[model samples]
Target chain A: MSTHARPRIGEQHCQECLVSIGPERIREEFPTLWTKVHGKPLVYLDNAATTQKPRSVIEALTRYYTEENSNVHRGVHLLSQVATQAYESGRTKVRQFVNAAHDREIIFTRGTTEGINLVAQTYGRRALRAGDEVLISAMEHHSNIVPWQMICEEKGAALKVIPMNDAGELLLEEYRRLLTDRTKLVAVTHVSNALGTVNPIQDVIALAHGRGIPVLVDGAQAVSHMPVDVRELDCDFYAFSGHKLFGPTGIGILYGKAYLLEAMPPYQGGGDMISAVTFEKTIYNTLPYKFEAGTPHIAGVIGLAAAIEYVERVGRNQIAAYEADLLAYGTEILTAVPGLRLIGTARDKAGVLSFVLDGIHAHDVGTILDLEGVAVRAGHHCAMPVMKRFGLPATARASLAFYNTRADLDALAKGLHKVREVFA
Target chain B: MSDLRELYQQVILDHYKRPRNFKKLDGATRQAEGNNPLCGDQITVYLHMDGDLIRDISFEGAGCAISQSAASLMTTVLKGKTKAEAGALFEKFHEMVTGGENAVDPMELGKLAVFCGVKEFPVRVKCASLPWHTMRAALEGQNGSVSTE
Candidate 1:
């Protein structure tokens, strides 16, 4: 604790509020944003793919491997115990962050991809029968789509999609109609990683629940942008990755309902996930351990905990508000560009701006922008369905974060002008 | 830098704007579609092969300037060349774009020399070589699409 760590009355939203003493200030804590590319300041607007880590999270990772490096669980040594405590602390942080009912419900997997696969393999493998349907929306990332597809294919079940409008919003009536007794599961994204469409998960969950169906919400793009209380959302399962939230990669959380997790079989059977094993018989461990099969990514988990702390300290509400303002500013400027067409114009959106310019390919736009030291992602964004729906080969996406300012958006607009000039 | 300017030379831009042989060949003996799925660069190579000689060549697709121009320039140079000669030229051109600048003379490449500067950008090497790979695939009488991963 430092003398300047405490937040004053109105300062509760910026930098420090809950910390007893000196917590690092929000943007100042991140040093990567100040990096220079090709003699220009790096204006990184590609936060959707992955986020830059803060000093605290980086330090936590280094501290873990440097000081308390040991295997977790079933160790009597001090280093192992400390490592185990740190790892379990990370799980507790996730449980609190998502407000899951039980700590045992928080399972740490590799990332969102593995988390989705874990659920799809364990729950979906058992739940889905032949001719059953797994309902999903049109705007889901490949992660949410492929896992269910794999399980459905294996189980002889069909994968059904709830189509979206041209504005990129999911049709609730279509979703409702798609929900049938044979619909084993509903998987939808809390936010579209490609379009930034914030889905109505509450209504989605309620509708699915009325039919006694479980819904899995992919919060990989939602958690960092806004506060997410899974208990409040009442989603049966929620999954998200650590790196997307400013933590290291190779770590993620899967929060499943206690009863559902208990009823489902273990995703993987290994040392940590087993109570006892023999040549003839094997008993599985408890909820969280049953899914986490191997020695987990200890440093990544610790870093994730620090990242969660960092986001909480900065205040998710403030992040949501700041990015909302950035989105509005970006939309206004980008839509006003001479020949630019904004792709995803959902009524409610955040963190993404995808568009196309007349007579210019998205890759060329990306290259020219890169020359100007602006990093924007130009591709299908792993949501090829979204691109196909919009009848575009690809799109230039400039996703924003809390660290971005009006100057960054202005630079993006200026870069578009340069792209226009280059083509002309 | 001079390298970036050279990579996007005026001639390359012109060819990109008005590609030389961007049409479906009437009597095509061989054809193959290729795509770089990452950037959505798609091209269909149509080869009018008279026995072993490529009497005419054409392409149709949408890609970045470097890819489209490289493909356009390839079609112009490969016309009337024997299949063996085309393969030999592909090797030389690939070496020029992906190899060291001093390894091959730009004057030896003629109009295709503009793409020699693409070697400065390791990522753009694929963009410059994608059409060549697809051409090689088509000359081999293959029907599958090629990908520059």
Candidate 2:
């Protein structure tokens, strides 16, 4: 309960100290991890799909619904005022979390997919002209790709993909070549969900900015694993989901630069987004409110703030170091399994291990792993382009999180052994 | 491991390892592609029919053990059966995998009974039935593609 008492994670001496406290302390906070599945202890490795919520986040949801459950923005009464204050404070927490320049730059959304679609429809629809190109990467999730595709198709713009190497790292040289005068916007993922390749987003942003192109980052997989500073990266827009960060589902944040968001049209027209209304001409609300239409997910925002606080308390630097060590151990152990070929081998990777067994389909591998109480995602992972790049129909993915330990990876290895045995 | 063993019986594994009639028909009267987008499993069924009777049936595809074995076993039982019989078989097979009430008798299913274990895994029902769905599509002259969404 006392986070301040722990040694500062980045200090040289505290690395071992955090290691000593280890995942046991962290795992205790997540109640679901302790549960059994298929008569065995659950080895939950599907973090990239969605993370397990900690007690603090769960309790935050409970607290919100039990006490401060009221509509936000328009309420003039005491409960409404309290709910509005809490909701706005959640926005401020998000601003601080991503280190956005202003609170008004943070827009509450229905997860990362909605956030990407918002910018693609509003900013992309406006800026794109005939024959213009919107550059995205090959490793992008379907969420990032499809929105741009829809907007581009509508605006008579073509979607250009920045190709990746065999190891799943983006080809920066090819990316540089793709950026040109005709390119209107750049959308890319900070970390690939399927491959776990931690993209060089700083370099990506710089290359796009050099061409005077605005960049939007899909940080759904990055926010929980590493510290993100929107100002430091200089990305014009960054979107992330709360569920992926151990918070409740149906809520996320889209951080855009103030000027860009001000210029863009509203994504949806509903109650909270309007300031003054008339049948003839209605005036829109200002800044973030202009984007967040209808009644917001008040409890999800509160829970997301709690999840952010929980992650901050654990220290992202320490979590990164711990997960890196675990990844190395995982890579070694998983490679030792005969016929297990890893799909992504990027030098700078975090949070996922996607692979395919020699003679086993990923669907079969998944069913076998589930029997051993090791949960993993097995499919194209909504990144069919990446699947086609490797000439694979599907790959079994075991994604990581800060709460996971070497023991969990060991269980995954054991499960793969069972998979091989079944196939043999 | 009882449930696992039941689901992945030796017979099913054998069929998956060496599928029978796993070839494309050169002069096929009917064909249909089946896709299970959830698992990326795809199968193309080819049939050579003569006057409402299946003279030769085969499948060419790649997928999991359940799906591959199901397709392999299906081709074995369906040869020479009438189009109406194939339709009835599809219903019975669907009911078997879904564990519906009054599930078809295992003895009646013959080799196809091995797939009865598929009922335990609801998510995989599509994998076990993809080939059958594709086969049904081929029979109906629905030539394009079918998806078990």
Q: Pick the candidate with the highest TM-score.
A: 2
Q: Residue A173 of model 1: what lDDT?
A: 97
Please list the C-alpha lDDT of all candidates, in the order they appear.
0.89, 0.92
The reply for model 2, stretches above 4 Å from the true place, is: A1-17
TM-score of chain A of 1: 0.95
lDDT of 2 by residue, B1-149 (tens): 77788899999999999999999987889999999988888899999999899999999999899999999999999999999999988999999999999768877788899998899999999999999999999999985899998
Query: Which 10-residue window of candidate 2 chain A scores lowest in summed lDDT?
Result: A6-15
Check candidate 2 and list the clashing pairs.
Answer: none
Per-residue lDDT over A124-148 for candidate 2, one digit per residue giving the tens place of the 0 to 100 score: 9899999999999999999999999
DockQ of each: 0.64, 0.85
> For all candidates listed, what's the TM-score of chain B alone?
0.95, 0.97
